[model samples]
Target: DTAVSQTPKYLVTQMGNDKSIKCEQNLGHDTMYWYKQDSKKFLKIMFSYNNKELIINETVPNRFSPKSPDKAHLNLHINSLELGDSAVYFCASSLSGTQYFGPGTRLLVL
Candidate 1:
């Protein structure tokens, strides 16, 4: 069983195409988040939700959106992707201060 899973470990596509990365967590946590890890390994918070309601939006572009069907799943969708959008997307959850992360989904734009 996977604690967290994100589809398409690597994605490469044209700049204008729309794409999505699915994420899920089974740790019974109430809060889940989407983060982007840049080439420097600095994890920046993009969005977060608790009980299916958004709790954080850290200056992320409107072209990027996140959806949570339930407490266990959070998915990201990007529209009209740009070359600057190329980065590693990660899903994470936290109960207190401890956070658990997914392997990450790498996106490349050409």
Candidate 2:
């Protein structure tokens, strides 16, 4: 079974559109996270959820939202997507600080 999985591995849309990416993990981890990798290969954490409670990174914009229905799932929603939002979004799950990442969802904003 996959430890972590993300849906719609690729997303292509125009600027200002809204989109969402879904993530699920079967690893029974208590902590999950959303990360974005930019074109320059810089990876940054956007949001984190531990047992369904949110802990968002201060640098993340309000346009980005992370929702967790339970410990095994975390979904990301983007509103009024901008060109700068085009990047690879990764879903990760951790047990005691050791993280396992999903394949990632590539978003392209035109």
Clashing residue pairs found in predicted model 2: none
List, residue by residue over 1-110, the lDDT tens digit for candidate 2.
98899998999999999999999999999999999999999999889999999876648889998899999999999999999999999999999889999999999999
lDDT of 1 by residue, 1-110 (tens): 88888897999999899999999888998899999988788889999999999999999999999999999999999999999999999999878878899999999999
Model 2 misplaced stretches (Cα beyond 4 Å): none
Worst 10 residues of 2 by lDDT: 53-62
Question: Which ranges of candidate 1 are over 4 A from the true structure?
Answer: none
Model 2 TM-score? 0.97
Most accurate candidate by lDDT = 2
Model 2, residue 45: C-alpha shift (Å): 0.8
